[model samples]
Target: MKNRNVILTGAGTVIPWGAPSTDKLTDILRQDSIFINDKGEPIGEYLYSLLKTQMGKRRAYNTPNFESILHFIELLFEYKKSRYSMSSSFFRINDFFLIDPEIQNKLEIYESQKLDKRLDTSFGTKRLIANEYYYYELYLHFTFLIKKEIEKYETVEEKYHELNKSFNRFLHQVKGENGIVRFYTLNYDYLVPKISNLKFFDGYDEKTGKMNVKKIIEDDYIDCYYHLHGSFKLNFIGEKSNDYSVCYVQKNFVQNNLIPSNIITGYNKPERILNETFYEFYQKMIEDLIKANKIYIIGYSFNDMHVNAALKRALKKGSAKITVVDKCSLEDFHLKYDKIIDSNPDYDMNKLIKFPNTYQMTTEALKAKAYLNGLNDFLDNLIRSNN
Candidate 1:
């Protein structure tokens, strides 16, 4: 049976209130005071308070440093759980965290030192005592030294949460045969999974290497999350000795030992199919989406050439209809198309083979229209008819 599908896109299309318009997003991104503390103080003031409390001294706190990075990460995770998960089915996005190069290099140095073997009990104790100061020093170095410029109107966390909720609703409303709904995101954040509470089927048996899909029964909502860009919580094989080891950026420091390269920041494209496990799973997601009756896109711009190529390949073989939900106009879509066509003339633009059966709608107009149009009823009927 054909499954009804909807895709929402924008900076924060899933927020309960609705995805902010492009103008609103632009304004928010431009503001410096957007990052606020729990008590509604500016981030700078909050950092000063924290430093005074910790160091017992009053000093000029630096902006664009590790302090802000840690604050941003903490605030991001905190907000996701609170504001984004009221009624969404699941939230998952591609790579969310982009680690800085300086931080990556430091982590690499620490990892190289611990390479040969697991530290013995005695060595572990001594190493902690010896490097405790250095660890904190490294923490401060990154926190105080690294500078991150705020985007003119972007609150990455806020937008992410908003979009997550919207997408969840869209997916949750899907009802039909046991057809699959797949999300492929270029983002590296965990907002989607966190907001939707969907588990990423990593295809591993806890007891064995045999891979399997975590099944969902009929009438169950289990949308597949494929992170084409990786994730913040992802860990490399053999990176940590114990399965229970928790890795997180506590305050400003990574609490667990992890190499910098594993963090997946910088401009580096992830190695294609790093392992057998990931390759099979990724291939399956692409295949499933291609075979589905409909494909909905939200938030992603299809800017990456590699991803665009993959989509083209999938469309060539699939009969699925494509709906691209973005904040762009028909003119904007044409401009993007012209650019793509210019670069890849071999792509059949005349036949519409690559982009035929595609639809585009502005996010703001869609929301207002959805309200007036009673989207829930429409979606329910669509699902029923399609199935």
Candidate 2:
């Protein structure tokens, strides 16, 4: 039980690999080759204008966050999806609005004859558009920015050789000891896999790339790496309803060479996990928290209440110890998480969130307790003592 070590990583973990922060992403997007919509409108300018209008004149300078902008796009897409789904003879659906212009021209002769009429003026159904194509162009740019940054790892940057080498050594040592470290990451970058020398498994089949969470959960101890948030190669595939017997529903996650995307960023992530693809991963996070003997929370902001609540419950048990691997000082950590810890009568935040006491601190004395290098030492020492 003493050797039960669990690690949770967040967005900051991949910063070393030239991964862009939310603000940095926005900055780069503003200057990068801008994506133009069908109307020859730049995607960023179009979206930013909408975003600026939403914020009102006083807050015009307030740049849009990844969450808010993505949420806005998602809401619009959902509205269009549902709005057109309503069956009615009275309404002429905008289905043809997104059709290829040449194709629309080809079908012009039969426009009135067709029940799903093309929205061209000659047919009496006005060619009204909703900037629907812009939604995809915006999302494509978002995905492109993130993917481009992470792909920088493909080049052997001389500056980070030592860091990657150190990471490999730690992973190799753990592999030699036959101990598994369950890495649950909220980041979508493939940085961890790029440097891992130990055997790795992420439930995606080596030959096919099909992910089966049920199979992953079964092989728990040794081969465990869960993406708590969606990743770059993951995409929504198909829907499966448990309504087979009025029981359950399932949705498929898909990916292809052309559109190797679908990472959950932007607003309402806590609410987004309710979907089938991400739900099981989050459920396992709580179980891992309860089971952990020593938990290492690394580079996380604690902005997610679902994650925070799990940490609170795990600490309330008064058995497991937690060490955050951030540069946040003890007092500041309390100020950041006091509301979450305050509600639980059983929690003594002072005990779990304290100075490293020993000289085992990794980053700074006043900031955070324990880190990867120190953690490797702890596990190695424990293995030696047991032998």
Most accurate candidate by lDDT: 2
Residue-wise lDDT of candidate 1 within 1-387, one digit each (tens)?
546342323233333234344334323322324333333434333433333343333333422333233333333233333446512233221123333454335333432342112322111221222232223223222221111111122233564553455445556654234544555555433445556644544333446533344541122234555455443333433121223133332121222222221123222232323322344445654555556566555444444455555556656654555544444444555444443232223332322212222332223321111111123333333344457
Question: What's the true lDDT of residue 60 in model 2?
Answer: 48
RMSD of 2: 11.3
Could you tell me every candidate's TM-score relative to the true structure? 0.42, 0.64
Tens digit per residue, CA lDDT, model 2, 1-387: 224556787775665556677677665554443444344444454444456555674454346765555555544344334445422332221121222344234223222221212322110122122333444334545655665665675345778776677666655553445456767888766677767765667767666565667666776666356777766555443112111112122222321011112555655565557644667778877877788766667677677677778877777765666666544556655555564564444343443423343223433322224433333344444445457
- Candidate 2: count the clashes: 7
Off by over 4 Å in 1: 1-167, 175-178, 197-222, 238-267, 270-278, 329-331, 337-387
Candidate 2 — which pairs collide? 67-266, 67-267, 235-254, 237-252, 240-250, 242-248, 242-249
As a whole number from 0 to 100, the lDDT of residue 326 in candidate 2 is 48
